[model samples]
Target chain A: MNPTACILVIGNEILSGRTQDVNVQYIARRLTELGITLAEVRVIPDQRAVIVGTVCDVRARFDHIFTTGGIGPTHDDITAPCIAEAFGVPWSVHPDSFRLLEAHFPPGEFNAARQRMATLPEGATPIANPVSVAPGFSIGNVHVMAGVPRIMQAMFEELAPTLRHGTPVTSRSWYALGLYEGALAEGLADIQDRHPSVDIGSYPFRRPDGRRGVALVSKGLDAAAVCHAADRVRELIERLGFTPAEGEPP
Target chain B: MNPTACILVIGNEILSGRTQDVNVQYIARRLTELGITLAEVRVIPDQRAVIVGTVCDVRARFDHIFTTGGIGPTHDDITAPCIAEAFGVPWSVHPDSFRLLEAHFPPGEFNAARQRMATLPEGATPIANPVSVAPGFSIGNVHVMAGVPRIMQAMFEELAPTLRHGTPVTSRSWYALGLYEGALAEGLADIQDRHPSVDIGSYPFRRPDGRRGVALVSKGLDAAAVCHAADRVRELIERLGFTPAEGEPP
Candidate 1:
């Protein structure tokens, strides 16, 4: 069975387009490399009710849950407490995180805004932030990280070595220039039927010279199956009277 | 009242991390510029059930709903029918869209795969696609468009004229180098309190020379108020013994 995960991106800045969410793609790519199936991703504003409802709903459905953004010191940053409420846990200043914050900004400098970063859910394990002192936390199966791409990436890299991984899927692709998708439909369907475990996708690409081509990609847990399916795709393209070009992996 | 909008990003490739979602940011930025508050963004796999559920939910919650991706001819592309099902509309070949598709891919070549591009929900009006012949459609307040950045931008440019826009919000950002967020805490709080209607945000940037700076951004519907607040930010930065840079409009 595939180990599935869901990501909840919490921030009003993201929804307002003030900030482009870079963490989702970073996390998704990392999860895919680890063989974890990222099933869904939801971006909700910093509103408490929405965040709480989405966290509860997604946590119930997916095997693992990851949330990015809203764990900062600002008033609009409400993800940590809301997520704690969703899990019915008490929220407090985590000792370890507080120590880390203290190390960065000593006593007099540690005001309300800086202190806010230390607050976390009860019984949560701190996810180390190599880039910044603001630590992320994990409660139950939910991993809450920072919104900033650099910080989120650092936290994920620190967390990755400990998580469970499934069999990594491999993919191969071939390109057919100036060939219509309709012309290869029947043969493509036949190849798909032959390889049940393999997933074949046809991506239409427009060349620099204005020629259209279909890049057929085959993906499967078994590398041999992926290779075999890709070979069938190449054969299908040739049968349709088009010479297949060696495709680059995307 | 704030005009609200929600974005539904539909694709299996996004969930699988094969594609990073860029359309959400494009839609969000454009909507925000029109003074439409983007309340939510949902990224779901190209599954009928999930798409329908999300579309129905978002449509109920927001003033306008915008969807991207999964309108292509591939088997995994399922956004149109799922949206139709959500609104209880019958799927049919739109005459105008059919003509457009036919014009792009002449007579005999207009096979099943190409034909799928013309399908739309009943009573839907076609949203012109400047980049591609396969046009997106709109039903009531929901605008459906392509996922490709260039295509999505083109579709939005076509649709923008028809959209009802609110008072556009203006923003200005003031920068201060080598100053920590902790140093500006008291002054930032004072500015925030003084301008409740305007949103003040502090974005920390690590310079190429390894210096840390905070870019304070002030936003509001009133341009004069935004400028006034930005001036206050510059004053605060100067008062703190830092060389304040002129606020750039954002």
Candidate 2:
């Protein structure tokens, strides 16, 4: 089994519908490529108690935990302190991180609040922020990164090389055209049962022209098993008299 | 305080990053317009125990709950039974729903799997699914809808009128170009402190060309208070020597 992971998105803007999150997709794709199974994702508010509780809960369950948002310089940037509290570590300033931002900013520009970015959990290493000077941090299995898509992507790039890999999961998908899920359900279930290790999923999509299609995806640690499941899915689609397309249906 | 809701996205495809979810944004926008506050969102895999646990947990905490995905015909579609188990109610086929799908599908098409769409929790009301014949359902405060964006939207439209409303939250935002989050952090904190009722958030953006900007958003049940906070954000931007642009910065 691949190492399991969970993502915690710490932003009220996301839950409030003020901002649509791009971080989850970015992290999910990155972790998948790194051979980690991205399991659960929770979009919660920037509340301290909630953050503290959730971090502790998911840390025990998943092999790796990623948290995005609330790591900025604003008053709403409460993630760092909460995370420190969760680990029972002192929230302190790292001199190296402080000097990095200190030298980058003008003498008078690095105010107390700006310096807040330099403050992280005790013993946590600062993850480099290439987009801006304010760095993210990592402690134990939890990797706390920025919320901005660009910044988060940068932080992930910096952190990716350090992570341990598991057996990489491979996936194959068939775009099932002219297929009703009802007609395909039983056969698909039989295929899933036969390939016990492969995780199969059917997603229905509606086209702009009012046509419907389903994307049948098969994923597993074994590439050949996943491919075999995909073959079965294609055959089932053919038996139902529908053409199975690869990638996305046009 | 506004009537709060939680969205439970029950899809392994989303967790696996196989698909980008458009449902959360759609539901968030709709809830905002209806004067309901979307408090939380959880994107979990299609696991029965996890679904039941999350549903029960959120149901006790929030005023309303909306779940999307896994309500299809396949064996992987377990949302209905899990939802029923969450409420300690029997999962059985509803006569009206069965008749609806029974009539909609051709003679041989309404297989046992197709009929599963008609299965729902005891004492639940069927929400109309105009896009597809398989209807979504509501049991108490939890509204279960399809994973497809189009179908979810249709079901939400059908269910929106039935929900209770709270005071609608109003938000206003200003884009600050050539500004730093560090420069705006203290002033934004001050503004947020002064207008305790409003929620102020500063978000940084990096353009395609790397022209950076920050968006200051203020939200509150009181429209005037939100606008006042937004004005303060604009003034802070001007004081920091950047132009405050309305809407998204060009």
Candidate that scores best on lDDT: 2
lDDT string for model 2 (B42-111, tens) is 9988989899999999999999999999999998999999999999999999999999999998888889
Clashing pairs in 2: none
Give the root-mean-square deviation of each candidate in angstroms: 2.6, 1.7
- For model 2, chain A alone compared with the true chain A gives a TM-score of 0.96
Per-residue CA lDDT of candidate 2, range A1-250, in tens? 7789999999988877767888888788878888998888988888899899999999999989999999989999999999999999999999999999999998898999989999999999999999887899999999999998888899999999998878777888898767878888999999999999899988887788978888888988889999999999989888889888987665
What TM-score describes the B chain of model 2? 0.96
TM-score of chain B of each: 0.94, 0.96
**A129-235 per-residue lDDT for model 1 (tens digits):** 98878999888889999887889999999999978898877878798888766677667877888898887777666666777778787887988988999998888
RMSD of 1: 2.6
Name the candidate that leads on DockQ.
2
Model 1 misplaced regions, further than 4 Å? A180-182, A193-196, A206-212, A222-225, A245-250, B207-211, B222-225, B247-250
- Candidate 2's C-alpha runs over 4 A off are A208-210, B208-210, B248-250
Worst 10 residues of 2 chain A by lDDT: A13-22
